[model samples]
Target: MTRVLRAGVAGAGVFGGYHANKYKQASDIDFVGIYDLDIERAQTAATAHGVAAFDDLDAFLSSIDVLTIATPAFAHAAVALAALEKGIHVYTEKPLAVTSRDGEAMVAMAAEKGLVLACGHQERAVFEAMGLYDVPEKPLRLEAVRNGTASTRNLDVSVVLDLMIHDLDLAISLAGCEAGGLQATGRRREDEGYSAVGGDEVNAEVDFENGMKAVFRASRMAAERERTMRIVYPSGTVFIDLLNRKFENGTPFALNSDFAEADIARDPLGTSVFRFLDTVLGVRDRPLCTGAEALQALELGFAIDEDVAF
Candidate 1:
């Protein structure tokens, strides 16, 4: 009989809370326990989800079949490395790690341990509209803008890691090429009052080995939120408005329409989490975003950071 997977969530923060709730509600798995440095927060989350709360990391680590690390970006490497070393499967929040080196190490360790490592880039699961279709043939030029009102979460990382990485992942998935070169420029927010700890808004252009070009813009200090992408291919153009959950395809289908009121059958986030669980149960060979694929996105983001003129 297939054993029920016991999943433990580390970190009782926003994303961690979401994972805990999903595990609790999922029928295929057991919500083993939740752990956090802050015992009160962990207890609160566990009680809300009807799961156990642990203050000790060692005990928590020894008890679960899988570990979901939703900690801050800077702590991802350390927590993931520890879990992988212990032969535990991992599902972590996006921007896998702060640096390419850490990201590579995490992937290597998971492979060495014969365990699955999934990154939470949930947007990839959005099936609303034609979001799943790949960019036809070669995308000569691509433009993506992901901006959001200031949020205190992930302030430790620049907007490139926090926001732009999403579009970078999508661009890499569509371009299907390793980044050949990248150039970027960024500026810190002028109004200190907007954020006590200022962060940079970055614009980057990346050249891919397959002769594709991509332009990306991301800002955490925007007055309003927007997530949009435009891909221009040889045949036609495709645009996705992630914020509005709408898409326009001008290629094979000459449809100039919107899906703002479309009845999405399932929640994309739920789909992503269930897919990860499917991977854990050996129902899927690999996740939609593999560890290596996520590493590539992180590497591209890091390259842009390095090339940024400051």
Candidate 2:
């Protein structure tokens, strides 16, 4: 019989609640508790889920065999490092960390400890649903646009990390190569008292080592929400309406026409969490997104922010 793992979420925010729900629903996971610096917030979430709440970080870490870090972007590394040191598997939400250094440290520690470290790049499931990874031909050029209406969430990081990082990961995964060069420009909305501190809009072009040119545009100050991608391959082009879960595939390869109905694509967050648990249980080789993969995405996000000309 497979051993049941004690799983906990290290946050009480919206994403944290989502992770907690996954844990609660997992058959092989013993949904442990919720941890947060804000004790009241933790209590509220834990109570809602009928689990314990922990204000002390160490106490929280001690009780769980696996941890899902839904903490703020800046706190991800610290929380993950602490959990890894205690021999706990960790699954961190996207962008891995605010900086490449912190992401590297978390990945290195997970490798050293022989523990699973997953990232919440749930969008990967969408590609899997569409069977994009099975295509042999690499993309010649890729374009992604992700925009969001004004919101107070994820203000601690720039739009590059908050929104663009998803496309960056997809672009990198599809390219399957290192980035050779990048150029970027962005504008912040702080002057307008929008509350977000860093870049509110970013446009970046990346040249991958495999000769793929990827363009990314992300905005947190958009009038409407939009998520779309266009992939140009040697054979033809594939356009995706990510927000609406529809696509127009022009490639010769057989892509799933009903990908939207697939469970993996429909509920990526649940699939990601379950995959992490399965990896921890030795039922799978890896999660939907591993630490190294997330680190690569994070490093690219850092590059875009640093190379911003305005």
Candidate 3:
């Protein structure tokens, strides 16, 4: 029997708890323990998963073959680099690092150590289900919107990083072109309690060298949550309703056709963890989102932030 890989979680917040549960449920992994700056949160998550909780980062790092960093985006580089330097495989949540410099450094470290570094851009699975992974021909235009009511989580960053990055990552993956240029505008709401970071809404347009254009919008203070992406190619268009988990395809832009269910509902984080284990066992070729792919997403995010002024 193959030995189950031991995994440790480095945060106990919402995403951290989710990672811990995924590790516990994955057959190929042994959920070793959890760690957090907040001891109580770590203990709570560890107990819920029936694993040990360690407040010491070094002790936790020493116990697992893999580390899942689910902390805030600003802290991703510091924590992940520490683990990578220790020769532990790392799976970090999206917006890999706050800046391109940090992201490049982290990627370099992982490559130097020959360790697997995966990002939490699980939306790629949705693209795979939509058959967009094959990289369609040069897209004439792309429209995307991801909005949600203010959630207390992950508000330390602007909506561009907090939410729009998902669509940006997806757009970059599907367009199969480097983010050569972009222009953006955004607004910040100071009275909304978390506006100190930036505005509550961001709208931007990205132009690829291949003549593809992508328009994206993200808002954290919307009346209702919406996640949708529409891609228009020369031949047909593909529409994804992320909120409802529905996919639609139209050639000649037809209407009234019953769209087929994609059934791509497996938990993405869980799927990510399993894929990481497959990498460890030499059963998979590469991680779903490699360090380079994540760096591209992060670079696009920074460009959007820089282009847009509140």
Candidate 4:
């Protein structure tokens, strides 16, 4: 018989709630509890799932075999390190950590402990559903746009890390190589009293070592939400409308025309969380997004933000 693992989530925010729900629904997970610095907030989220809430960090870490760090972007590394030190498998949300140093530390500790370190770049599952990774030819050029109306959430990080990092992960994964260089332009909303670091909106172009190029635009001050991408391959082009869950594939590869109907695409967060669980259970080799891949995305995000001309 397979053993069930105790799973817990660190954080009581929106994304943390999502992870808690996934854990509650997983057959392999015991769906342990929640931990948050704010006890009341943790209680509120845990009550919804009929689980325990922990205000004490050490107690929370001691109870779980696996942890999902869905805390704010700034706290990712610290929380992950705490869990990793306990010999717990960790799955952290995207941009892994604000600093490459922190991301590297998390990855290193996970490796040293022989624990699985996964990132919540769930879009990789969507791309798998769309058969993007199965294409034979590498993309020559790609374009991506991700915009959202102003919100207080994720204000601790710049738009680059909050929004653009998703596209960066996709771009690097599709290119299957390290970025050679990048250039970017951006604007700060300081006058408007928004506290995003680096910038609030940015447009960047990344050149990969394999001669591939990807252009990305991200804004947290947009009038409406939009997410789309276009990939130009040597043979053809494929345009994806992420928000609408549709695509126009002109590539010769037999991409999944009904990807929106696929289970992974319909609920990528579920797929990602389950993948982490399966990896921890030794049923899968890796999660949809690995620590190294997320670190690459984080490095590129910081690079793009650093090169931004605000």
Provide the lDDT at 232 for model 3.
Answer: 93
Of 3 and 4, the candidate ahead on TM-score is 4
Per-residue alpha-carbon lDDT of model 4 for 69-130, expressed as tens digits?
98998999999999999999999998799998999999999999999999999998889999
TM-scores, all candidates, are 0.92, 0.98, 0.93, 0.98
Pull out the clashing pairs in model 3.
Answer: 187-199, 188-199
- Candidate 3, overall lDDT? 0.83
Residue runs of model 4 more than 4 Å from their true location after superposition: none
Model 1: worst 10 consecutive residues (lDDT sum): 256-265
The deviation in Å at residue 19 for candidate 4 is: 0.7
For candidate 3, lDDT tens digit of each residue in 26-103? 787878899998899989988988999888889999898898999888889998998999999999998899889999
lDDT of 1: 0.81
lDDT of 1 by residue, 101-178 (tens): 899999999999899998987666663234444333778888999998867778877788889999888888877779
On a 0 to 1 TM-score scale, where does candidate 4 land against the true structure?
A: 0.98
**Which parts of model 2 are misplaced by more than 4 Å?**
190-192
What would the per-residue lDDT of candidate 2 be over residues 35-119, giving only the tens digit for each residue?
A: 9999999999999999999999999999999999999998999999999999999999987998778899999999998999999
Report the number of clashing residue pairs per model. Answer: 0, 0, 2, 0
